[model samples]
Target chain A: MATGWKYRTAEAETAEAIDRRCEPRRPLGLRFALMRIRVETELCQGHGRCYMLAPDLFYADDDGYCHPTGERTVPAELADQARRALMNCPEDAIILTEET
Target chain B: MTDAKKYSLEPPEVARNPHDTYREIRDNAPVAELAGRSQTGAVTLSRHEDVMRAFQTPEVFSSDPGAIEIGNIRPLVPLQIDPPHHRKHRKALDPLFAPKQMSKHEPRVRELIRDLIDKVVDQGHCNFHDDIAEPLPSTIFLELLGLPVSRVDEFLALKDGIIRPPARSMEERQEKVKATGQKIYAALEEVVEARMAQREDDFLSTLIDAEVEGQPLSRDDVVDIGYLFFLAGLDTVSASLECMVAFLAQNPGHRQRLVDEPEVIPHAVEEMLRYESPVASAARITAIDTEVNGCPISAGTRIQVLIGSANTDERAWDGPDEVDFDRESKKHIAFGAGVHRCLGSHLARMELRVALEEWHARVPHYRLADGLELQFSQGIRQIDNLKLVW
Candidate 1:
């Protein structure tokens, strides 16, 4: 039982480490790199304007709420689109975060 | 006095001194059970803290059953659903209304506002609601949704039926609501189908292809979402705009302030929203028995969060009744709070900001026509017929 428990714990830790390493690469040296858009799951009311404005960057997952496209570097051309997506969120669910 | 006894959801006179009645309720009974023989039987939370708390916990306060019943038209979008589910829908649509996204349409919104204002600025006398307030937001909404401009009248008529039912009896009201809702639903269904077939770059197409939980949203889901956007988008903004204009007319000093310093318009819009909230009470059902303030509320009790009243609470704000454009720390419940806050808040703000800036730049001075009786509807409390002359 002890050996089996140890094996299970090791497997869980290995999986978590892999997830951490495989996480999408955030934009590097981006001006708004630290800007975090926090989405409040509860308040979204889903008017769909966010997806309508920036389809390439933001897509609604199957549940009908928006999620950012995998961490691709914010291209210079799409920065404005990102800003619009952040600001236009009707529920004010998106919050911009600046990393120190 | 407990909120349980002080206020009736139905005010004494629809138009007369609503603020005072609200104040009475807020001070006397923060959460008063409003006897409902008319619409859905529900209670009201008039105090700032109480209303704020209700919005904060949406699981207990669902925005479902449609804010005001309009027959079979169920709210299919994010607002009606509880958390987890609500989050997904909100995420899917947030980008469309972002401030930057709205900037692309700013020029058009300004043009529409200018055109509407131009029609009556010269007349020097016109019903603000009919000539300007009603048309401006409706036009903008149609344009944004990529709907046909010609359907504006039909949309407005249907909106009115749902918002302020004129049918003599509840049954009549329900029937009218059903008829109007059916028209809107059918129109939306057709628009969605056409957009899907054409595969255009509009909101409809985006919604058609949007995936949730790895699956695209259903066609019926798209219609329900569109219906919410159509119904809630225009009227709320128009009402708020009407209130802003009326307040400015009554206070020429503030009007002059905007004319002199247009930069203050954004802040001024915040003040107006706080002063006269367009969307009044949003409904929520308690998921569990909760204690708010000191009162114990049972699970499943319907609570109506009176946003307008909460915005004026002296506890949260200083000189709460006065519309001070420069008020620092102007956090308000006008757009609601937590996850269920208004999604189009930024767009609505932009529209109002531009409208005020342009109006003050052009018209400058205006007044209410003498002997004109101001009116108020059930859900919204503001001047129904504002006659302005510049």
Candidate 2:
């Protein structure tokens, strides 16, 4: 595990991200596709931002490269974090996909 | 913008202060040609978008042998290897430098910082560059590589010879670097042979036992890999520390923020890395004839991806010139981007964060020495005369 020093910003961002998520998400009836985070293994250069930002949704392997945390679908609470991870990845390896 | 402008990076003026020059080139000519240097036809991509494009499209922009000459007999492993093969080496090596792996060394790193700080804390002033910035990283890296820390001066000299050779002409520079390169190879060979005879608890021993693509790395392969790590581990963090400390010395408000709020050190490090960009530029070769933002480049043309410019490009960030520790999204590529991004970034970040934490705790207030002008090194922006007073 990386030291707690790295999480200071993540903790602060989590609150802001969650607050933004509370602006009434799209109606379930209109939401036809299910959203999930995907780790494109080939593209990942192990920058480690994804796992650092979204620890619950993502985890690192022995090589410190990212891997999905058992579940691919982004939990309602983790949506903001998933997006934050996606946005911060230098390699653009993280993908948020809609499953039809 | 249609014609590639010529800019010489060899000048001491640009070396001392590059942000203005970088901004000028970025604004006027995104793709500029090298005015003076050994790599004659080399061109630089100053725009953030183009730099990122080069990193992403490695097929078009390669890191193969012809990219740059650094006195290496063989291509430095992984750094010179592109895709497919690059992946194998990374898989075997990435785990060694991971954040978790690197964090284990934090305590010792902190201790080293305290020791270095203790020596100068009582004094009203100290040469931050010589007394602290230079020694800290080299000592730590020496331990990591299983090399004797006693010979750090010798090792650093060899690295400087290749990176910043003192010479009147390009021929002289290459000749000096080549001779230094021979010495470096001999040194690596001596240690590698020792490790082979009896394995030890070090990176070299691990690499010797570890496999790339299920085959053990050859003796030459280990030397090549060490060749890259030798240059990288010894210099990069030292340069980063100098740059960051120099920035803080000039900016008291920013310095106070770290002392007041220790938690912001991590973010501040990232922001400074983005702003300082000590590594400056990365070398690559045009693998195929490609056009960058309407400027057509021929195949095999040397490319200098100006990372310093990219981190500050307005198109990439809002208020790019502003240095904000609390900046919301720091996707800056101070560690470059794409597949060939810096492997030691995790370790580098840990070192920077811990060093800053300890320095502020000990010497909270410091400013550049009176009448002292900092002259940054040409390739890697290290300050040899970064004197500071509290």
Candidate 3:
């Protein structure tokens, strides 16, 4: 257990992140879909680099621990920045997926 | 040679570029010993992996040894306190410095930056350190702590002594450091007491009402914490600014690249912070007997983590000495890591980012002023004066 932690990932979770960029895309909805960004709670140390890199996509809790905004699916125009945010997370907690 | 005799954090050599000295130490004895602090009192760890290991496991490697690094001055709250207690302070204080607040304060920060830049943009030449870098952080820090900006010079002078006392002998330096610490406490006590009566939306007020481990902090606790924030906040940003400006002045192509494409500024700032970390060395101690890479560290022994050296360790970073702004996944220990990471990092980044943004926006070309020596303090990498000309 991470001592003195209010926000954390489960015991079974791993810090290694999965980026869906290299995966084969199935053209179903004509490229307009909500991109699901997941946070592995256990791995997130709340460094807030995601917020710093791309504030439009992430926010911090009262304890200053960062949280992805409720609206995870970003526009195609912001896809690049969203990827940068995922890449810049100090803790490998953020994952980008092109799902419904 | 003995561990203590093998290396020195002193001047003559270190005054030139501590990074070079750190690389030398990290290459051979990665965990170099702190001079005058006994044979086994404290060991300086320079490799990125080793530094991270110690910072992460503060349960074994205690941070309460900041006083030793600060010339045996009184212990700083939160910074010197180990986990659980440290977490409590951070929980209450971290939110105030979050990214949310960065946006809230961006305009004011930009205003401050522009105001400073305006003073010298027309002159075509100015002392970058004093005119711009030094004032920006100090002003923000003072406002956050609710300290009077009118006392900026006073606070800066006190900070200088607190971080790097000006004495040759170790004993004399320690004594002066003690006096400076006492003086700062005496001055801040009155301010804290007044804030206790009528609180404001400032750091001191927040701390005054803040609970650590479900209990309100005592007057002394608040003062100690404030002391740490002032010392930690003021000079570090200034030192970094000097280093960055000095680097840019020498490397016109890098500066021109930023001038051409401002998008690269954030990554460039990260590289700069990693390359020229102002808070180069941080002190820790062993809470219990432990082993670091087979080093048998005993309890109560001081351990100095050479953050500057770790960032330059070739084992961790490719071409560690070279500043590559476009370098992918640049993870430097400039802000340390793990639970005890710097609370003001977000603000520091914003300040540096803003400084670069506004400076480049207006003064696109500048160079180091000729024929003047760039003098920096030994402990904290600070240039008292940095002259720049367009």
Candidate 4:
């Protein structure tokens, strides 16, 4: 469950702006956390679970290995799906992070 | 150092229901010496964590030729090759079996399954194994390999000769597998030679032109890759179909659910694959000294990672024995883990899902023939006489 949010000073502002644009449904002032999705290609055995579960966020290469589809950063709307892919990957290869 | 406990995997009962023995081994001895197989210095790892560790650390737990004898003269391509080289071969092969590529076969697979069901539906009872399970995947596999579908029986016989050799002793088993291996090689050679002379739009011809590290694969490499696929593509899905259908026939409640809500068939297939892992154990050998839970294992020792055990280990699940389709996380190493995981998984999953969907739609109410005890063959777990009645 190490979300890898330690180095947040650099990308946090830009991530928040992207999240607001992608997820306008988010309440105006309460809080905004930018989510990121990544696949550790080395650990990924091309199980294809990430692409199988979260098609919008991931697509498989010719080798069946996963690559982020649109952007590495996730919108709030797709957070549940990103988590689903992370949880179901047998290799535990999917990395999900939240930037505050 | 803790002495390794002895566990026998040869008992008929164990083959019928291995989870109980797996549970005992995990609780009492996570790493137990495999007895009764007539193989020395062999051990079984039953714990999920240990199994995963062994798979991930293939540098220590190597899958070279010495791992287990399947009567191949050389290490099967991609499967026996360690990383770097293995990655290259897989890169050339994975795309051919990728989900998108496999999805193209969905229509054919469904049509085949429906055709098989058509022959059996009118009958009050049918030997689901012999009638549907065995033929479906083998036919598809033969077609994929560009081999003659008319020769499926011959190919299946050759496959069974190696997998379920009807021998009482290890020497006899090896001898039989070796002889059968020669026949398989000759058969593959004939096909590869023909394909080389006149290429076709199939897996064999594709592999002929495939490259690894900027060089086209040698003829031997193509044959070696075909050898692996010949065994893999024919058997695993068939065994899975047999296991799943047998389970459903016995469990009326679960079957009714599939009939009621077809969307759940995929999840149900995942659960059954975990519960009755058809390819129960995967073999490896130690390239260097290794230890399992503090027990020392020297180099060259044989290891059998019990995927069935890991799928049901209490340490890995809340109720390990229960089969729940609603599980939020259904991750299991039934197809195996690491780089050598089964390459045909997507094809197998699609076939299973479609077969179940069509079967439940046609014959929703069925059960195991009364007084029949399913005799699942060891290793692959195919129930040759899985009769069911509606």
**Superposed model 3: Cα runs more than 4 Å off:** A1-44, A53-58, A68-100, B1-4, B34-40, B66-74, B211-214
The model with the greater DockQ, 3 or 4, is: 4
Clashing pairs in 4: none
Cα-based lDDT at residue B96, candidate 3: 77
lDDT of 4 by residue, B1-390 (tens): 234445666687888888888898888878877667644667788899999999999999899989888889988998999986898898888999887788789999999999999999998799998889989999998999888899999999999998889998888999999999999999999999999999998999998988778999999999999889989988899999999998888888888989998877877888899999999989999999988898888999888898999999999887879887776666888999998999998889889999999999999999989999888887788898898999
**With candidate 4 superimposed using the best TM-score fit, by how many Å does residue B110's alpha carbon deviate from the native?**
0.9
lDDT scores of the candidates, listed in order? 0.70, 0.84, 0.75, 0.83
- In candidate 2, the second chain superimposes onto the true chain B with a TM-score of 0.97
What is the per-residue lDDT of model 2 for residues B1-390, given as tens digits with 9 covering 90 to 100? Answer: 234445656677788778788888888878877566653678889888899999988899999988987899898988999987888998888999977688889999999999999999999899987899989999999899878799999999999999989899988998998999999999999999999999988999999998987799999989999999999999999999999999999999999999998988888988898988999999999999889988889999999899999999888888878889877666889998888899999889999999999999999999999998898887689898999999
TM-score between candidate 4 chain A and the true chain A: 0.64
Instruction: Give the alpha carbon lDDT tens digit for every residue of A1-100 in model 3.
Output: 1111121121112111112232334435655665656677645656766655554445565555765433345657657657776776654568888755
Give the alpha carbon lDDT tens digit for every residue of A1-57 in model 2.
122324532233553453344333443654555667676776787777776667655
DockQ of each two-chain model = 0.04, 0.33, 0.18, 0.29
TM-score of each: 0.78, 0.91, 0.84, 0.92
lDDT of 3 by residue, B1-390 (tens): 126455766664475477777877776777657554322456778778888888778888888754274633456777888877777777777777776676577788899999999999998999887899899999988988899899999999998887777786767877887888787887789899999999998889988988866899899888888888888888888888888888888899899988997877877888898888878877788889988776777788788788888888888778888888876644676877777788888788889888899999999999878886778776568887689899
Candidate 4, residues A1-100, lDDT tens digits: the string is 1221111111334434543444324344636797776667788887776666565556666666775433366767878778888888999887887877
**Candidate 2 chain B: worst-modelled 10 consecutive residues by lDDT:** B1-10
Please report the interface RMSD of model 1 to 1 decimal. Answer: 17.0
* Predicted candidate 1 versus true structure: per-residue lDDT over B187-236, tens digit per residue: 88899989988877678888888998788999988888888888777588
Docking quality tier of model 1: incorrect
